[model samples]
Target: MTEQLLSIHELTKSIGSIMPVKGISFELKRGGCTALLGPNGAGKTTTLRMLAGLIPPTRGEIRYGSGDGHTDSWRHRIGYLPQYPKFYSWMSGMEYLSFSAKLSGLSGKEALRRSREVIEMVGLQQAAKRRISGYSGGMKQRLGIAQALVHEPELIMLDEPVSALDPIGRREVMDLLDRLRGEVTVLFSTHVLHDAEEICDDMILMVDGEIAEKGALSELRTKYRQPVLSIDVEPGEREVAWLDSLANRPYVQEIELGKRGAKLMVTDMGVARAALIQELADAEIQLLRFEAGTSTLEDMFMKVVGS
Candidate 1:
């Protein structure tokens, strides 16, 4: 069985009397990607800061299962990249990474070696000698990741790593994240739903200082399976009324009133489709089109959050 990388129990953090993260609890397993998702000022940053040990929790416990102080240890095996990364203007990218490696307890030679490898890993080898001041937003973020990863950390937590990036830059960062899939356990925080939909194996959705939902994306979809069938019809009140009556049908779950037509969610969609089609044909309502709508992450988010 795989080892547990991170575990938090009733973790809470308050900023000058304002509760930022109130009772957040979850566990991160080794070698998988988990995303912390929420809207603006939703305690994501505070949560990550606590996990990185930058600030002690105001209440409750955050247990780092693997990283403990020891020589030749796993404490050095954790990497953390903050949302807005800052670096000394005078230090070149390679120098910054080498410094990080040294801080992780590598020898001078080993630090240099790891720095070189990480620079290339983050695709900064060509600009390795360039001062950090000359780097772009994307470049600096990548450098932050390179520095964090220089020690070959097993667990990595990045706080909004793609917040300060363009579409192309975000794609590059996402690609780098994908490359780290099987190699490291990643816990990243972001407000972007599409990003989570793209790379997250599991998600922890926080709302107003608490976890509103948590589970695998697939599992959540399964639990709240609302299969929809989109129907297009000729303009007629009779057809609309006929479709609306489906709301009371035993197999039909619900009907979403649309501009042109409507969507029907039901169990055993095949039977539902046949019955609805037969009813429509019997009513002489011209059927323009029909298709099934699978629930998406966006749909799930709106449903869960009621927005």
Candidate 2:
């Protein structure tokens, strides 16, 4: 078993009078990507900030590597990138990265080297010397990621990194994050379910200041209904009638027929699937093709939150 890098016990946070995070607790593994997903005002950012030590929890305890038998300090291994990173407009991209490195305790020569490395890592080397004021939104975001990783932190928190990016820019940043998969532990918050589904190994869905569900993607999928199987056979009246009859089955939630064969909303495939295949075989129906379909992450989000 791998060691835990960060642990929270009954962690809670409140703002003056209102509770924003209510007794949330979970463990983050030493090297894994865990995405925090929620709708707007779901306390995703607040939780990330609290865990990053930017804002202390109002109650409960957070320990880093206390029982892991490690010697290095945890703070030096944690990096945080907020939704919007502030940089000096007068400074060049290279200068900004170098400044960030210095603040993270890098020496002058080390800062310069790390700065160059990160600038290139974010694919900003060509524009490294360009003033930040002239940079585009995507460019700024890449620079933000560079600064966050400048300290060589083992655990990084990215709060809505792709929220402000366009499709292309989002893909770029997501690809960069994908490259860091095994090397670091990432706890990123995002409302984009597709992004989370694409990049996360595990996820925690938060709603109303609490965790609605947490687990590996496959585990969650299995816990819920098996994926809906959408089949489009060759168009024919016999096929349509056959599919329509299947709608009466308890496992088949809904069925629709058109120029395509049929679309089924099946709740369980473990038993219904074998029965379906057998039914088709018995009827001597020529099966064009069949596949298992799945509800999107958005569907899962709504289901989990009961919204």
Candidate 3:
């Protein structure tokens, strides 16, 4: 079995009376990627910062290396990148990585060598000598990641690494993260669940100030997925009324109404399908479209977050 690299217990953080993170707990296995997923103001950034040791926890314990206190060396084995990483505008990408490596206690020669390697790893080789001020948004983000990885830390924590990038840039960073999987333990925070789904094996879903769900992505999907029925009818008063009335049916567990459509979460797809078909026939409703499928990760996310 793979070892648990980090074990956090009831971690809490409050700033002056506003508690962003309220007693959240989870574990990260070695060489696994876990997404700290949440909506805006879900305390994801605060949690990541606490894990990276940037801020002291207001309460609870974070254990590393068999939960022992013998050595603080675990500090040296972790890398972190904030939501918006600022760099020395005058410094080139290569210079900054080397500088960061040296700050993390590497020898000058080792720092230079590692810096070059990481720059290439993050596709920053061509822009290695480019000044930070001249780099694009995506380039700067990648450069930030390069610096974080220069020392080859065992665990890397990133906060919304792709949140600010364009679609192409987001795709690029996500691909890099996919490559990083299983190479090192990663605990990155993201509001975009699809991004997490694309790269992570596990996820800790947060809402408000606490975790609403945490598990392997596949397991969570299986647990939350249910029979979903989508119905479309032409714009008409009777059509909307009939669609809305389906929500009150016992077999129809939940309903989301659209302009000319309704998505229903059914308790039993087979029974619900029979009843709905009978009703449509009786009313002679003009059914434009009907699709029955399983719920998705995004549906589960909205349900848990209640937003």
Q: Order the numbered candidates by TM-score, best leading.
A: 3, 1, 2
Measured by TM-score, the strongest candidate is: 3
Q: What number of backbone clashes does candidate 3 have, counting pairs of residues 3 or more apart or in separate chains?
A: 0
Candidate 1 lDDT over residue span 42-153, tens digit each: 7999998877777878888766666543222445767899887879879999999998899888999999999999889989999999999998878888898888788898
lDDT of each: 0.83, 0.82, 0.88
Please provide, for model 2 over 39-74, each residue's C-alpha lDDT reduced to its tens digit, 9 standing for 90 to 100.
888889888887777787888877786474322345
Give model 1's clash tally: 0
Judged by whole-model lDDT over C-alpha atoms, candidate 3 comes out at 0.88
Name every residue pair that clashes in candidate 1: none
After the best TM-score superposition of candidate 1, give how far the Cα of residue 215 lies from its true spot, in angstroms: 3.0
TM-score result, candidate 3 = 0.90
Write model 3 residue lDDT over 92-210, tens digit each, in one string.
99999999999999999999999989999989899888889998877888888888888899899999999999888888888888888888888888888888899899999999889
RMSD of each: 3.6, 5.7, 2.3
